[model samples]
Target: MSDFRADTVSGKLTTFMHRARAEGVAEPVRHEAKRLILNQLKASVGATGQQAVRLMLDWAMAEAQGGGGAHVHWFGTSLPPALAAMVNGALYEVLDFHDTYIPCFMHAVSGVLPAVFAEAEAGGHSGTAVVDALAIGLEVELAVATMLMPTGYYRGMVPAGLTGGVGAAAACALLRGLDASQTQHALGLAMCTPAGIYEAAGSHTLAWITGNAARTGLQAAALASRGFTAPPTAFEGDQGMFKTHSDEDRAKIDGILASLGTEWRIFGQTYKVVPTETITHGPVECALAILPRAGGRVVERIDIKVQEIVVTIVDGRRERFGRPSSTPQATFDLCHCVAAAWLRGQFTTAETSAPCYTDAEVIALSDRIKLTADPGRPTFEGCTMTVTFADGSSESHNVDYFLGTPNARVPDSTLIDLLEQYGAGVLPAGRAHAIADAVLTLDTAPDIHGLIRLLNKD
Candidate 1:
């Protein structure tokens, strides 16, 4: 194996992605990649009718009214490659049900999948090619994120939009069969276009950040493919990505490069069983676990002790916890999710909507929940919940790992079931099953266009 760390970060990544092969990837890694792809498709199809997705599709379609390029998965429409990527990417993230990389605090699939799908459809690439590009894209995104951590989110910048653009660009470059230099230029161009804020959490604009990242990335790769030039040191120079976006004087660039092809971070990605912020999942699980113990007794107060990250991101918005006006606000509130899960026994996509958010019973229970940061708790994956009944009795439950974490990964059957459930809302049962089957065996499919076609609603 060559020393990928010896080259510039961008150069090293370009070489790795350009040379990546499906056959070279381990079976388990490939399986995980397929699951991630399927998860993204499931999210896209599930959120097809969302107001945010509809708005983005309308805008993208209008932008590409005369020039058609590639298919937008599940929408049965074609737009220019960049516009298609934008719509598909927005759909993947609009529901906040996509896969997440814990280390980077980013949505791993939404950012990269749209670019890969768009480029593959436009170029008529194979499923193997799409898989390879996805793996490469994830690797680059994870590595960069790992290096710039402990600051991006703290500074109000959304990691998915900040780092996702470069990841999408890398995937597009690989699909376009660009040389190492061109791929480097693509990353450079993408690095200059980062735009997403933590404040977008409770609005439709949050999804737009994800969509814009996908579009910008595909556009960057397209420009690079056409001999566009960018500085070679776009990621490491005095005014590079790290300097501009990170508070760290020097990022762990060496460590990021050294682990390029040796480690597969995709295996560590977690699926969102609930349609809310990933940090709230543990608390939601805790709430559900204690529900049975509480029996028919009325709950008086619930105290939740979570990690610092949770308090920073989910607890600050106390006003929205009791009564959220929208799905985004409700999903961002830990108390709202816990209350809903406790009352309904499960948190599904429907629970994140306006009707559920404004439920009188849910609001009453949510108002009683109090959240506090546990300084000793190291990560946001675990939470301790104590619920006191009206009769003064109390029950406590601690959750160290949620359902979709690496330790408690959702089974393939559960994933298929989720896909069927979500897909059935938009697609026929037969079509949903067909789409699932094709995605499960996607590695062997001759062309990715067939898979995209199956995703269309008949």
Candidate 2:
């Protein structure tokens, strides 16, 4: 395999940006991307008041306002675009409620858009430009993430912060109309600002890293727009990103970028059927879907087959499973998800965030659940669930795909309804409806400023 780590990956990124900017995206894909963006905006805004989100936004807003370098529009408020991007990015991720891709372990849109929106708004780019930038950033981030999947990096390393800076840079380069060389410079600048850590997973640091990635990505790209430059060999060469942050599989890296435009990475973006939990646990949801059949009273032993990485992240915090104190803990807890599903018959944002997380009954049930990695199952998908009852009867269900994913796409109407459901908690009913409508109609809008404005409407 060729050493992609030693090659000019930044230059390749520049070339790809040129092709993306010049060729542009298909109308259909652009529309889909807009819809996804709208969904993410709603999700982020809805999570704005969350404790982790508030902390992240507070820091980001202070940083941008403190820096006073640029003015930008925040999604839900009149904050600077850079600040807004950072805060909104953080908010979107606070609940870990945003979209995720299985192959790359990347939180796809949320990480890139905050920066993209910030830069686009700051630069006064058109909605079409915003969409283009968003698509470019999304593609680049997904490409990098897909290239590095199944490696140790997937454990807790935020792919968004790592690759998102590059994505944001790509978007900024495209939006700013930078040339190929300048785009390379932007990418290099982005790589310098790789921000994320697995240690922040169970804490508020996850949101901070996400928001920071967005802000830094925008900063990097914005710098490149004005002719600022950094080391050209950021992604490749001896002292590059991969050698330091990840185990570089040169073949995978090259292959990820090889079939670029011909194969759309946008297709890899998967929406969430359930608003909580990481994408790695989607199949757990599939298993939980059948728990209602077992009857709430009879579930004696619950055995779940999950990916090893899922087990690692979820293993810690068994006490949380038994008694979830926070929304983040409840959502990320396998015991909570399954226990709630069996007891309440559903897994919605409301259920996970409910006071029931601390309820004795839920915790009692959670204690009965057990999760084990299925060696036969791929890390990306597939989950088998068995519910053995006290009545000497057992029921098992296996789900190959979650509600999201290309294999089982959520209906547009249903997804809209789900967004409305989430938005209703934070926004007025009419406002939520309008937001959903605006998202669906985002493609035809003149600019995302209006969309951003719409998202912030309480």
Off by over 4 Å in 2: 1-7, 60-76, 152-156, 279-284, 316-323
Which digits, one per residue and each the tens of the lDDT, describe model 2 over residues 304-389? 78777667667765543435677876776777777777677676766667576877778887888887877776754567878888
> Candidate 1 has which clashing residue pairs, if any?
none
**lDDT of all predictions:** 0.82, 0.70
For each candidate, give its TM-score against the true structure. Answer: 0.95, 0.90
Which residue pairs in candidate 2 have backbone atoms (N, alpha carbon, C) closer than 3 angstroms, thus clashing?
72-80, 72-81, 73-81, 76-456
* lDDT, model 2: 0.70
How well does candidate 1 match the true structure, expressed as C-alpha RMSD? 2.6
Tens digit per residue, CA lDDT, model 1, 250-293: 63678768777888888889987777888889989898888888
Please state every model's RMSD to the true fold in angstroms: 2.6, 3.7
Q: Which stretches of candidate 1 lie over 4 Å from their true place?
A: 1-6, 249-251, 319-322
